[model samples]
Target: MTQSMATRATVTVAAELTDRCDRCGAAGKVKIGLAGGGELTFCGHHANRFADGIGTAAERVVVESGFGWKGAQPI
Candidate 1:
């Protein structure tokens, strides 16, 4: 079965951002998927800043494991 256009777009953006982040020596995953399908990556600190942007730019942000802290759980 053929993939939908949105799926294809998301894949393409993910791949592109992943490569860019790697080339840039970024530590964490290249977060993609915000409003209008925008893609971007963030280091340990900036990840939080981009968190909202990621949610707004693409449909969903893809987070790479082994890059950032998950924070403590609430009691």
Candidate 2:
């Protein structure tokens, strides 16, 4: 497979397998990768709450809203 295709496949798998928030254990809606190292997972609520602090330091940030997932149901 081509490099971009492989990267897409990897991202799909990661999305399927990623666990819940590191803080409250709710389903993660945002993923933050650090420039130095490590990563953080947070639900939308916590992600927004902490964005001012950690967002500035992140090297990469991926956010998928709750409405974008197959498993998410209406409130």
TM-score on alpha carbons, each prediction: 0.41, 0.60
TM-score for candidate 1, residues paired by index: 0.41
The backbone clash count of each candidate, in order, is 7, 0
- The best candidate in terms of TM-score: 2
Per-residue accuracy of model 1 over 1-75 as CA lDDT, tens digit each: 332222221322222334334234565455655566455655545554444344335565554554442221111
After superposing candidate 2 on the true structure, give the runs of residues whose Cα lies further than 4 Å from its correct spot. 1-17, 65-75
Alpha-carbon local distance difference test for all models:
0.42, 0.55
Model 1 alpha-carbon drift over 4 Å, by segment: 1-25, 68-75
Task: Evaluate residue 52 in candidate 2 and report its C-alpha lDDT on the 0 to 100 scale.
Answer: 51
* Pairs that collide, model 2: none
